[model samples]
Target: MKISCSISFEQGLGERLMFFKRRIEKKTYDKSSKKPVIKSSICNGEQVAGFKDIATGAFEEIMLIKNQDDLVEFKEIYGISEEIEKIY
Candidate 1:
């Protein structure tokens, strides 16, 4: 007897896998010197969620804010509760 199994990537399985991967992965930044911010592009209106250095005014890109879900995920991963300032 022989048995064979095949998995198709056409379905939404890939997205689920990516979601799980993101959920499992955790990251942290310096809260004392860094604050949550959303950097927006003036020309294209692109938004990027990240942490900004309070003293240096430097931004570290974390993820793209495509929708509300992405923003929620970003906040959850970073444990941010307060409002995030937007910069252009």
Candidate 2:
């Protein structure tokens, strides 16, 4: 099954990694200073895929929805409690 998630960040890559480290309960590191720095990964039970960009530092996962209502249904099913300010 294809699934998508959106993530937003207020700081740079370093801060974003820290956020995900806490949210997904995973290990993260600060390597933003390196050239061609590695960013986060989006994955399912099978494998890692891709991620979405939010702002300068923020990011959101992008998934293909069957319809407009599908997006709403996903939000409900996942129990996304935060208020998501959508852009386009």
Candidate 3:
């Protein structure tokens, strides 16, 4: 799963994490029309996997990959990849 993020400064549980934003499209049923429709919106910076939850069917969550320090855990769980560092 590839995501785009710019510089981020935050505090608390998601502090060490850098901020990232991405625009996404979503599908939902319209109550008034009683039909399915696609809606597009922007998902703001959040916990690393936050977008994964929002993206839904657009992607399957393999591992809840995060910052550079998580590389060891990511490697342990998902195995080695040369491009892993690019995520942070």
**Segments in model 2 whose C-alpha atoms lie over 4 Å from true places:** 1-56, 81-83
Residue pairs clashing in model 1 are none
lDDT of 3 at 47: 23
The better-scoring model by lDDT among 1 and 3 is 1
Q: Residues 1-88, candidate 3, lDDT per residue (tens digit)?
A: 9999777667788765544544333323223332211222246322232112223333223334355454344444433333431212
Counted clashes in each candidate structure: 0, 6, 1
Q: Could you estimate the TM-score for every candidate?
A: 0.71, 0.26, 0.26
TM-score attained by model 1: 0.71
Better of 1 and 2 by TM-score: 1
Candidate 2, residue 39: Cα displacement in angstroms equals: 18
- For residues 1-88, what per-residue lDDT tens digits would candidate 2 score against the true structure? 9999977665765554234522322222223421111123344222111132323544334344555554554445444434444332
> How accurate locally is residue 6 in candidate 1, as Cα lDDT from 0 to 100?
62
What are the per-residue Cα lDDT tens digits for candidate 1 across 5-83? 8654454645522323344355678899999999999999999999889999989998999999899888888778888
**Candidate 3 TM-score, C-alpha based:** 0.26
Which regions of candidate 1 are displaced past 4 Å?
A: 1-24
TM match of model 2 to true structure: 0.26
